[model samples]
Target: MNSEEGRSRPAWGYQALVSLPARTSTPTRELGRRALFALGLLVITVGLVYFDRGAYQDNNADHVVSLVDAIYYATVTITTTGYGDITPVATHARIINAILITPMRILFLVLLVGTTLEVLANEGRRVFRDARWRKRMRNHIVVVGYGTKGRAAVKTLEKNNCNPAQVVIIDGRPSAISDANIGGYAAIEGDATRRDILRRAEISKAREVIITLDRDDSAILVTLTVRQLNPSAHVVVAVREQDNATLIRQSGADAVVTSSDAVGRLLGLSAVSPNLGTVIEDLLSSGDGLEVSERQVTADEVGKSPGEVMGERVVAVVRNKTLRRFYDPTVARLETGDQLVVVRRSDQAAAPLPSGGERREFGGRRGR
Candidate 1:
């Protein structure tokens, strides 16, 4: 597509939609709240006019006032639609009109103007927030697809101490973007597979890109696009089929998670041995149960056997970006600058690594 494709894609305004859930309310909810308040004012005005029917004079009817005429009077009065058909002739009614009703009318008018006022305020905030984001967008993670897998990935990142501000979500579905926003994240709505959409996310400056699309083909396309944009970034892809995993990895994903195969394996294991599956699921799950974390070798742990390490169980070792099984003789003893992949309890905080430790994807097969 041409560079102007972003401009002509649709009427959806990306800048207008950027928001932090913690700071501001969505336009829809704000408008609804104001509308409800305005309605309440109308109800109170109607009650006041109807309850004191004798205080008002109606030109259209006789000296008596009906509920319908009271409602009509309140409606026209609050809206400043002076039909001249209704008048409050009593001294008390006129005094109430001067003191109370006038203020309520001013409030209703303020509420009406509030819609425009809030828009202007939010617009200015959006512009400032967008500028700040673009300025500080370097080396942040870009996650495409806010579906089940995408949500889980982001949660895992956050649980590992990753900042919510450091992660950006890209999804083609408006509903998914809304969900992400409600979760207190900035989300861009558009097809992530498109180069222009990826560019809008500042793909080139991103430190990592995660692709968890439902369709394997789409996952591959996004992986390719991300790799093309940011070659040095660590790209991860979660695909449904194992066959597509290889293709995605070849497309430049650092690691590939075969979702369907992993789930199937867990199902089979559960059928054969229930406890084994439960333990694995616990490791896969976040929080106090069990977690598999990759962290740097502490000074005391260095020059020691993996089996001698206290508490967490060392499952594997990552040396120079290569994964080595714990049983492998070379990694039997940890060395300085070595990274260990260990299964530890979530209640205890894992030691921070110099390179920013990451959580490994569970239930995935890889070459040692």
Candidate 2:
């Protein structure tokens, strides 16, 4: 059994659901351009009719054509809804109608209906692409929540070279999904505990599942559902209470993080010794501090001891899918296929350690 099998799980619960603003697409610049073009065409057509007033007549009145009448005539003619209340009488007016007015009407139609057609075409393309993406999605990671812990875990995964495109987010809140979409991750908005929602996320084909639901009960249910759907996939969960850890493990969680107890211990350590707390924090953080990384053992170091490896501090070794401490007698002599879990500077490039070299300590100021 794995060392994490007996660890306590946290018992955090989801808070009351809050309504978030629905995502709305703003008017595109193309639509605005089309509108302005159509407006200009209307204005020019009205002006032409107004100036050539002597060539036209209003059937309803004996009075000369007015600006309102000119605009009304232009509107109806361009819309192809000719009311027959206005007519061009002179030969020049008839010729101009065939040449200029007809083309203007065609242009107006294109501008007005073109936008609607483009919108529909783009929507069709989007649907087709989404369908294709779903079919090709496999060995991806599904994140059940977008809360603080979930977000942090995602960031860490991304920092460690995991592809953001392969990460799927499932959250109940629309705002959380919107945020995930904005960050370029695929997101499904629904209750994660539901089987249908998990199915929609392609849970069966996923390689890993991260459950960060707020409620311990919800987390357990989701874990059970996910385990049933994908028995082989690794499942990691966070709970707030220690007592519920066993339940989560029984539910088939491969790893459990007891957030409350971890935080409490950190606080106590910080109060007792500030430097020790800072060192632990540095080890947990990435980018500007020490980070924990795992890599396969190099061929040249196949028969060497972990203590003989220069530069990095090897904490543990993974061999044949089992973890062994660096100090373990069985692990003392490094093997060809063993994976080393070591602590190194976050910004340092990974390279094979030189033989018979001394260990180097990395500190914030020194690394900088």
Candidate 3:
């Protein structure tokens, strides 16, 4: 989207969108491959002329075609720079030149010109692709920031069967945007605090927004803007200070993760009790060891106490959008409609998405 259309753009900033699962090749690598092909053609031409040296004439180095002369002749011929010093005198040699050398020359020139055209064509394709992607973007996730926390959030999403194509990134740093593109996610290059930038990402239509900006103030501003644009979108923000989490949540963030405090707590646990810390870390990390999952309660488990449930350890139960610890008296019995957050071995089969369950999403009713 144009800045003028957004009415909230900075004078110096512009939007650059990159969509996911992009099949891209570096310009240098493409060019190098083409160059090798061109070189191979030259080599073939040189070999043909050298083998039939008796049918050629080199005015500069006697009537005989030396290896050097054949190389020079091939180079000039393929480049269409016929210096007239080397001439194919025999009828067979002339025929060979017409049939083989001429086509190779044309192909070589086309290769050179095609490279330039490819670069321009790629730009037009990129613009067209971006337009299509923007039009189709709806109910997608927008990740504002590409730092460590943001990266981890995306990784977790992917681990849980989330398509990387369903995520968009918004970052002020060009390098971060580039990384997002490389990682197969559409990205907008600009400050997340800017409404125009968010609009470029189609934040109004996004299903969720994750803000992991460098500062708490920026996170709050972004949360407010996103909530203003999309009131129903579940907004999650990460802050360095625990004290700012409440303010961020008040600013419309559905959930706030204090990055610094969480890490510090982990460090403290690791220092005091290594095994407990390691187990906690394992639960938090995906893809190995034990994993925490949310699944719908089976019909057989209805009215059963949390302790009676088998196959996995039930830690919490969710019913009617309320979270209840498994040990809580209110959630002592598992209801058929309730969802359970359980800890299971990574090798175990994962629970399917429940008809009414929120995974990695904040689900408590908060005062607005």
Candidate 4:
């Protein structure tokens, strides 16, 4: 199993045991073998301990073997740290001693060595695979900044079940250390604005370039460079001020998120009409929030008025730099340079009509 799969599985205590019985018989039998091996070593060690007693009692020809001394000598012998405090005097006992424990000692060493080597081999293979992954990747998403919004975006992408191997991030400031959690996702340390740093991040091949830098100017520059390198890439730039949104969008960004405008409107609406705000919040959030969507009227809706396109309310229609209130969708005209803000009904796809208002691309296309 791969490391990720192994980690995802239940702990060893709960998982079904495998290959154990075939190699070593039942658990009882395995325990018995281990016990025998241990007992054999104990016997050889006890012989060594009694050897000391034999030395003092050689003239008497009788030496009592104490259990405590046997245990001490057993530990010393198994560890191969015999202190010379014990010696065997009887020739037959010494010869029998070597016969009993030497084979068991060799078997223990072999098992320990094999297990250690196997562990080392598995670890080495994992390191090699990680290195290979780092060297071979391109056209992936590279998050260039780290903050609450950046973290939320990364998490949302991950939650969508996107492959980790396809995402990369670049952030140089020490404050962006939290981004390290995405280690398996490609990462590099350097200034994102520097063309060389962007090149190292493989910006040319990236599918999406997100500029959520803490500073607006940095985001603007990053947006410009990314558009110049990969004009087709969908770039999402975050602007702290609402006015900067147009600037970022004009710099070749597909979309721009205004933090202040969103936050301020949310707070203001919540204060006057909390219930309405809650409903809107749900739509904006992952939950069942009201989804405010926009679609440019295509050829189908060319003759039809705004009411047919927006079944409910036509909040506002934009023509050039002018913004006009259009409460009545029936009277609103679908003309060039006109954008209709409509509330979605049931997550259904809205049909497009012939363009009459401003030529505006809502979801997919960006106005150049």
Instruction: Please name the candidate that would achieve the greatest TM-score relative to the true structure.
Output: 2
Candidate 3 worst ten-residue window by lDDT: 359-368
Pick by lDDT: 1 or 2, better one: 2
Regions more than 4 Å wrong, model 4? 1-136, 159-161, 173-184, 287-368
Error of 1 at 154 (Å): 0.7
Model 1 weakest lDDT span, ten residues long: 359-368
Clashes of each: 0, 12, 0, 20
Would you give me the overall lDDT of model 4? 0.64
Pairwise lDDT winner, candidates 2 and 3: 2
Per-model CA lDDT versus the true structure: 0.83, 0.85, 0.84, 0.64
Rank list by lDDT:
2, 3, 1, 4
Highest lDDT scorer? 2
TM per model? 0.64, 0.68, 0.64, 0.45
Poorest stretch of ten by lDDT in candidate 4? 359-368
Order candidates by TM-score, high to low. 2, 1, 3, 4
Q: Please list the residue runs of candidate 1 whose C-alpha ends up more than 4 Å from where it truly belongs after superposition.
A: 1-124, 350-368
In the predicted model 1, the residue pairs found to clash are none
lDDT of residue 10 for candidate 3: 47
lDDT-best of 2 and 4: 2
Clashing pairs in 3: none
Give the per-residue lDDT digits (tens) of candidate 1, residues 14-130.
556765556557776777788899989988888988888898988877758878988898889898887989889899988988887788888998896767587768878998988
Worst 10 residues of 2 by lDDT: 357-366
